[model samples]
Target chain A: MDQRSIADVTVLSPTGRIDLDTTPPLQDCLLPLTQVASAKVVVDFAGVSYISSSGLRALMLGAKAARAAQGRLVVCCLNPAVAEIFRISRFHLVVEVQNDLAAALAALSSSAAAAYRHG
Target chain B: MTGKPIHMPRLRLVGQAAEIGPAVDTVRRFALAAGLPPESCDALALAVDEAVSNILRHAYDAPVDSAVTIDAAADGEGIEVVLADRGRPFSPLDRSPPRLEGGAADRPVGGLGIHLMRTLVDRIDYRREGDVNRLTLSKYRTAALAAGAPRGEDGADDTGA
Candidate 1:
């Protein structure tokens, strides 16, 4: 997983399969981000070819932790296969999903601005 | 249409979570060679991984080593994958799919693997014979392959009995 920070949003670009063998690393990567308050995360699935239920469970925990911390998690650029899994399991409803990175970043930026206005 | 011998492969692995990789790899290779679409191959691989993982996690509680066997065959229009385990008998089809109507904070963290398997594949059948539990997943050729061919089942049973 390659991670970079743009403004307040952390972008995680994980390549290859996110199955039983791979989800632990993904969890480690996302755990710290969800610990901080108001942390924004974007997982780019453009290079991910497949994701098993184990991966989904890890993401669910991360999303829940992030929510508890008042943070946000968004996923984007899912291939049709991965997207179908997300849709069927309703992970899309749990985590925000965008078509691409640009859209995700834009949504994050607007949400951040809204937060600033509310506070 | 040309007559070609269907490719069938049998894989056996210890019932361990780490062994799911090799099982999924074997299924993906067979699916690709059988002319399945890339997305279909990924879906099939995911289903196999979930099934094998469930066996490793839920089937055995004792220290005894167990085995999970997977048999795959293609009949020109679709592929049939059968996974058999000798551990305690449990049917994944009996579990209901998790409800998706709730928000993220209220959603449960597990139980989506079987739901994905049910939705991604064209057909799924579960049965137990004696001490073995068998789960069959079938994926039919969709837009990527020629359609409207009579479906046939290649009886390549590798239950490892």
Candidate 2:
């Protein structure tokens, strides 16, 4: 997983399969981000082609954490396979889903988007 | 779409969390060679991955020395995977589905694995044979896919081989 901060909105691009063995790192990297008040985080799945339930569970935890913290967690650029996992799990209802990074960035507070452009 | 088992590539591994990935990949390669469609293959792989994880996580007291046996066969009809573990007599099919109706905070965090294993494939069966726990997952090929030609070898990912 490669992470970078875009004007306080953290973008996480996780590559490869997110399975039982691979989910702990993701949870470690993601869970704390959602705890900050009004935190904005976007997980980019462009590099991910497959995911299992463990991964979905992590996302669920992130969503609940974000909700508790009054923050936002969005996921974008899911391939068809990964999208099917999300659909079957009904995770899209839990976390915001977007088409791409740009859309994900746009879904946050306009202040964050403005910061991205002007930074 | 239950066809007679053609050939079996039995995979036996130590029942540890790390072995789940290799087990899923082996079942996937078998499914791919069986001429399953890409979507069905992916679903089967995920189901297998979940099944193995469940066995490792729930069945064993300590999985270091235990074994999980996987026997998968792909006929022209569909794919069938039989997983056996000697750790415990747990039945995953007996569990209720995860509550998808609620918000994330209201939902439990861990039950999605069993739900995915149940919903991803067409059929799932569980049986306890004496001291062993066996779970079978089946995905039948559609009429078009069964009648169509096999996928090209180029489509196979080179990770496990």
Q: Report model 2's TM-score to 2 decimal places.
A: 0.88
Q: Quote the TM-score that chain A achieves in each candidate.
A: 0.90, 0.93
Model 2: per-residue lDDT, tens digit, A3-112? 99887799988888898888899999999999999999999999997899888989999999999999999999999999998888888888899998878988985766
lDDT per residue, candidate 1, B1-161, as tens digits? 12453756578776666678877988999999888888888888888888888887788776445578898888766888989888888877677778677777888888888787776676677778988898888887775442342211222223332
Return the TM-score for each candidate structure: 0.82, 0.88
Q: Report how far residue A13 has shifted in candidate 1, in Å.
A: 2.2
lDDT of 2 by residue, B1-161 (tens): 45567756688877656777777877788888888888888999999998888877777776356578898877767887989889778877568787887678788888999888877877776777788887778788885653352322211222132
DockQ scores for all the models shown? 0.67, 0.72
Candidate 1 C-alpha error for residue B137, in Å: 1.3
Candidate 1 — which residues are off by over 4 angstroms?
A: A110-119, B1-7, B62-66, B142-161
**What would the per-residue lDDT of candidate 1 be over residues A1-119, giving only the tens digit for each residue?**
79987767888988988987788899999979877898899898999988899899988988998899999899999998888888778787889999988788878897544443554
Q: Write down the TM-score of model 1's second chain.
A: 0.82
Q: Residue B1 lDDT in model 2? A: 40
Residue B115 lDDT in model 1? 81
Residue pairs with backbone overlap in model 1? none
